[model samples]
Target: MITSTTGLYLTAFLVGLLGGVHCLSMCGGLVGSLTAGLDPRIRRDPWRMAPYQLLYNLARIAGYATAGALFGGLGALLLQLDAFQIMQRALYALAGVVMILLGLYLGGWWRLIAVVERAGAHLWRRIEPFGRRLLPVRTPLQAAALGYLWAWIPCGLVYSVLITAVSTGHPLDGALVMLAFGAGTLPNLLGIGLLAGAAARIAERVWVRQVAGLLVIGFGVHALWSLFG
Candidate 1:
């Protein structure tokens, strides 16, 4: 029944890992553009560029963790209301459904989740200008700022994971869950910044995406099944 905190962390991480194909499509272009804006010397040398990439991604993950904590707190507040058990069950069910929808979206089998992204479009527009100002990144700070701002970009994948975080019902647990998820995403995004073209090509493969999608779907199915078990 996935009782352990460790199990929850693993699920979050696997979801992030399996969802990399979607990450490639959603953030790959942005990563490529940002990397291109780096100082010529840093952009040319792998060793020099590595630090900027790390800072950028780490800041982005930090943003996710921040959001997760906030949402988790909200979930905890909700559970304090009357019928706490009912509320908890409802939240869990919602998390499972969102995960299933995310899996479908990742597989390209359904586009409904895009609607959720659209809902956040206005907020992203406001956030995007700040990111633009950070461009032509000459320092690690700029890259980090850019990454932090980009974390607010309208993304179904991020939102889906946030739902799972909210189900944790504890701010610290939620933050940790997202931290693990962000760690899972680190490799693919880092690769995109450093090896943009190759990473994009590999992620573009139809079978690779389908397989990842199915695996994620299995996680959701198990989550639902566990409720009755």
Candidate 2:
């Protein structure tokens, strides 16, 4: 039998990979900006760039954990309400809609995702300053902290995962689910953060994000169907 811990680890790894692919578009630019001007020789040295990338991802993962904790707490309380099941189904439905919208946005069918992006603007504003302070980060710890903090930026993807957590019923379980989601994103992100130019070329293709969006939407639909059917 798969223990909860095993499940969490598996979920985290899968989600990290998928999330890494999904984040290619958003993260590519940031990684480039972070590592723009090093010497060609240094840039080519995986030894140097690897640590920076690792730190960046570590920070983002930390952010996901923090958000999971907060949301998990809320989910726990909400579970006490008599209408919890109804609310969960509603959240699942909303997540499906958001995933579809994200798919459209990824496919260039819609550009109005600014509305969703704006929702996290306030949090971003607060965190942006801290990221700036970590500029030219030379250590793994620094990269991790910055990435952890950066993860809180409001995102439709994160929002989708949040809803998934809430629906899990147990607050701790919900949090772990999101953590799994974050872990799923790591492989791609670690690659992109370390090798921005190459990763960007691949990720920037219109078809990739569209397909990822579709997969996410499918997950959302599956959740909803399982709930209501």
Candidate 3:
């Protein structure tokens, strides 16, 4: 489904890896919280728990695909509308700024990023309870569904990618781009969920977070420059 040039594919992969890194901190809690109910015996069994973790991640990826498809379709509809270019560029600029703010937040420069995320609070509240109901998820399918639903939680990283996807100007392409982005995170998420303590320790390091923030901010700046230059 991904047919981009080597460079674009590599870029998508790198972005996915970065997204995974961001999730290392934010998503670890969710994964831990979800897996907390497992029997000590089950938790100790890597073979059984591993499948659940993989399924949970796949579900989340599916969610990204769904979002990508929806946004891509929206972009397509917008393309047919009058003044779509102007609207698209406006969205590009806005998304870029949001990414910059997200980077700053990641860098520990501000705490207000939560406020931007809270804009989706109402929807999240509605969906979150449903996710909780799937708690102590035993089956891979259940874990996947929960993960998919959880993917919609307000995340600046995902939003940044969404903005990039929409700017591609084709709904199918947008969806594929997001899928590529999601694929990029597989390694990190898979590893972190399985090795919680180590992942958390690595993510908590100041230098690691700062480097990630800088990379995201650099991307945001580049996006802005591309739009206005």
After best superposition, candidate 2 residue 137: deviation in angstroms? 1.3
**Segments of candidate 2 deviating more than 4 angstroms:** 1-16, 19-21, 37-42
Question: Where does the lowest 10-residue lDDT sum fall in candidate 2?
Answer: 1-10
Top TM-score model: 1
Off by over 4 Å in 1: none
Count of clashing pairs, candidate 1: 0
Cα RMSD for candidates in order: 1.3, 3.4, 2.9
**C-alpha lDDT of all candidate models, in order:** 0.84, 0.68, 0.75
Cα lDDT tens digits for candidate 2, 1-229 = 1224455446345544544555777766667655654456667888877767776776687678778777777877888999987776786677666766665666667756558878889878988888778776556676676687678776777776676566666767766777787777777777775765687677778787667656655555654565566
* C-alpha TM-scores of all predictions: 0.95, 0.84, 0.89
lDDT of 1 at 169: 83
Ranking by lDDT: 1, 3, 2
- Candidate 1 residue pairs that clash: none
Cα shift from native, residue 84, model 2 (Å): 1.5
